[model samples]
Target: MKTIIIDDDATARLLIKKMCNAYSEIEIVSEFSNAVDAIKFLNKNDIEVIFLDIHMPLLSGFDFIKTLKKATKIILTSSDENYALEAFEYSKVVDYLVKPISKKRFEKSIHKLKSVIIKDSLVRDDSIFKEKQRNELYVSIERRLVRVPFSEINFVEAKGDYVKLKTDDESYIIHSTLKKIEAKLPSDNFLKIHRSFVINLSKIIDIKDNSVLLQKEIIPISKSRQIELITRLNIL
Candidate 1:
């Protein structure tokens, strides 16, 4: 992800940059000693993440985040641990990394960023999926909650600890286990295709080789579930 460092101390900025060198995914696009110049750069360019200092010379970190109308993820860096709760009120702030930040702690923060991206992706997918349905399930996106019809749901895919709900319009990720959501769904219409996915039987437009086609997307049907899917179709 693209990121920028905003801190008054050059030494602190250098240290933070050095720590970021450990990861290939994170790139420091620029660094600013004050929030004023940083704000100008941010206005013109889009940044996925920010390493913001809690205390600065003129404009504090809290005030800097407030200036931007659009939301972007932030990780607050500070010597003091007191403002952690206050920082959370700003939806953009994902974590509070206490200084001097350890490599392990920094790595942990990177992991968190990955999960956030996955969760956000899931939410986006879910929103699109819901938009095309007649009977839908709703979830939060940005600040608003939207609905998606159950019939339009194509399937759900599991990635690590998260689940991706795929529909006709898009797919969504929720930080939930598949088993938990499986219980909530109607088993009569949906069937587990693989260990990682659950497909809507009625939504299958075609079954080719080892995969099932829904609309334009092709989803794999596991060897174990192939017979069950065929049987569920009630072939004479």
Candidate 2:
């Protein structure tokens, strides 16, 4: 797995690097003295694990974690123990190691990293399989089966008992509920932004505050769905 070390202290960075070198599975891709440089590197590179220091010169480790677009496993190395509970609030933070870390403790952290990586890989593979199996959907319209490609769909809206499927060139009002059609759509491409609205993430032209612009229509995004939508986006 590719790994990066971020610590203000040169001695601390060296110690973590030396320990990580012992494990053949880990490859030290880069090291940084501050979170700013690390964030810059993270923007362009994909890393499996980050060995981070909780306290830094400018940006704290927790603040840095919030800036991440992709979900990457994090192991926090800090001298203080008071922030352990707070550190676990972030789902990506797998383990917290106190300063002067022992080899045994480091080994345990590595074990946790391996477990997370395996689980993530399985989930990714399952998602890929689902995507490969369902690329297009057939909808009943006027006694005819109309094939709609997932990529062409812009959004779906609830209109009384029926749902309207809006595409680039045309729109179809099917005799179905939004909930029913939502299940048929791929989760990676289609997201239920509101109780009445399911928007294709790729078709989004702009997102401002609580609303998203798709073609000419502005759909309101529910508060609950905002976090999920932001997580799906590759924001810098």
Candidate 3:
């Protein structure tokens, strides 16, 4: 994959570049000492993956991603491990690595490129499915079909004839059955939390006795689906 190195630390960037050089398929197009230069490069250049450092002067790795129009796979490199959970919030961030990265772990991170490909492919499929059913059952309220990232949706609530897609900021009521929408959703990121609810496992805030707190909504756990939800969720 075509790649770039964006880290404030010179040594860290060099190490990653060396590691990437070992692989025949990987290409190191550019390197930046700060996110601003990297952002500028990204604006014009085409890249598939980025090795970014979380802590940088002025512009952070997190902030740089926010400015991008096209999302590319990111692997965060840092001296500390505090930002691991926050890294997962971004769909583009595939992995987090601490400083002094070992060759073994570096290779593992490269292997994660396949996962990014899979997710991008699934989203393409979802787009095709939406276009096929666009005229079939769509709400007519000057509604815009927003691409709610798989990471943003908390859970879905099924009514009699429609399903409500609940996200972090808002909810949209689509004129469709749970089964149809469920088929379009990515199985790896989202789970059938309940018979009537499909939830994004990453957005789960807390898990109570018989319910899961997803964002601001609390979804019930059906007796039959509890085991399945447990398996899908990474509960600590």
Q: Which regions of candidate 3 deviate over 4 angstroms?
A: 129-236
lDDT over C-alpha atoms for residue 186 of model 3: 71
Q: Candidate 2 lDDT (Cα, whole model)?
A: 0.95
Query: What CA RMSD would you report for each candidate?
Result: 16.5, 11.5, 16.0
**lDDT comparing candidate 1 with the true structure:** 0.87
Candidate 2 runs further than 4 Å off: 136-236
Question: What pairs collide in candidate 2?
Answer: none
Ranked by TM-score from best down, the candidates are: 2, 1, 3
Residue lDDT tens for model 3, 147-226:
66665677778998888988778788877878887777777877887889988888888889899987778899888988
Off by over 4 Å in 1: 134-236
Tens digits of lDDT, candidate 1, 1-236: 89999999998899999998988888999999999999999999999889999999899999999997766789999999999999999888888999999999999998998788789889989988765442556655556666766787889888888888888888778777788767767789889988888888888888889999887878898999999988899666
Tens-place lDDT per residue, model 2, 1-236, is 89999999999999999999899999999999999999999999999899999999899999999999888899999999999999999999999999999999999999988998899899999999778659888899999999899998999999999999999998999999999999999898999999999999999999999999999999999999999999999898
Between the candidate structures 2 and 3, which one is better when assessed by lDDT?
A: 2
Candidate with best TM-score: 2
Superior candidate under lDDT, 1 versus 3: 1
